[model samples]
Target: MYELKIALRQILSRKKQTLFAILAVALAVAVITVMMAMLSGFQDELVRSSIENNPHIVISPQDEGEEFIHLYRYTSALIAKKEGVIAVSPKYLGQAALEYRDNAEGVSLQGVNPESEENVMRVNKDVIEGDLLTLVHTKYGILLGDRLAENLEVHIGDLSLIHISEPTRLRRISY
Candidate 1:
């Protein structure tokens, strides 16, 4: 009891110093709390946005060198038969360079069924100039993303040549 009283008296003698020390600690704690809350909210929003923008589940081939067609077909069937599956669409992705006269821009070539792709992806809504559904029955027609189209300087109805190097080089004119 005597020691407690002495300690209290010492603390009271340096009241201003104790208050400033307490205020500094409080300021640090408040800043940290605000930073944590903001970081948590930002992280949650980022994750939610990424999930919303991308596919719920992605089906890819197990082996990289193996034929993706067979894997995609089998997976599509299984996905279609699954209980919670809303839709299933097969895709063939390849990298290529878009060339028109002197302009050359690297791009990704995505082979997808336009009719079926609508149910699987939000790409239909993302088409800025051309209708994605138009490519359903058209074999030579390719739907380009806005950024891709801008890089190539090609219009909706304009034609562009895609030069793909898949083991060997292949060129195809796409509208």
Candidate 2:
């Protein structure tokens, strides 16, 4: 065709421009491909790390004053039966004040089934001292973090009294 011949002649005449144009297109494609791959990798890494470190979802009560979650056992059992459900842990969260003579520290407390919590959180991995598993056999036992223990001026095996304030009542936790 006459048009094709003319186009070929033009491309041949502008050899440097044609080559530069091709290189530019190839470079653009390469950059876009690399960027897409990097973004995908970052997304995967973020998802994996987040899932490993924390729970994917948490089901809680609609009422703020509701300390107890009803049907939690059934809910946990049902969730466990689902596909790809790793672990289920029911937790009772409370804010309490710990008093040891003149030294008093307000702390957030968590009551959990140790075995299930361990399966979900693997909390024992972070322990610098003491056994997190001992909670299984511990009755009214308290596991204090090193920093919190230092702040409260307490040590291992030290007995202390903690005061927990509930939504409608104030209660004392004896340890």
Candidate 3:
């Protein structure tokens, strides 16, 4: 068409300006490509870390009114029977205050069946002092995270007082 020829002539006439515009578009596209790659890389790394650090599947209560222990007991069996599950461990999680002689910090307390816990989560190897499996049947025995232990200024055998929030009231348990 005559219009196509005229447009081509116009672009050819302003060579420097056309080149600059093309370069700008190329630079913008390159930036967008790099940003997209970085975002995808970040997402992949996050998913990999989560998969490596946590369980493949977590079976939790579906409703707020159900007790966590009830959910754990029921789900443990169901998980054990599931096709892809290698092992199952009952989990009990509660919020408590970690206390030492003078220092205290509120922490999330988790009770796990250690013999089967290895199948679910990779235990941190740098834990300095306590046996991870020692709390299997030990009621009132609490395992503290490294940071939490440091905050409370306590060692493994040292006692800690825990204050928990119940449905209707607060209760204190010494560990």
lDDT of each candidate versus the true structure = 0.75, 0.78, 0.70
- Predicted candidate 3 versus true structure: per-residue lDDT over 64-170, tens digit per residue: 87657465666678768978778776777777665667887878767677678755675635346766556665665666667766776676676656667743222
TM-score of each: 0.66, 0.64, 0.61
In candidate 2, which residue ranges exceed 4 Å CA deviation? 1-51, 166-175
Measured with C-alpha atoms, the lDDT of residue 169 in candidate 2 is: 33
Off by over 4 Å in 3: 1-47, 69-71, 124-126, 166-175
Backbone collision tally, model 3? 0
**lDDT digits (tens) for residues 52-73 of candidate 2:** 8787788888798786779999
State the lDDT at 161 in candidate 2.
78
- Give the candidate number with the greatest TM-score: 1
The better candidate by lDDT, 1 or 3, is: 1
For all the candidates, what are their Cα RMSDs to the real structure? 4.7, 7.1, 5.9
* Predicted candidate 1 versus true structure: per-residue lDDT over 82-139, tens digit per residue: 8988888888887888775567888777888887788877676767666778776566
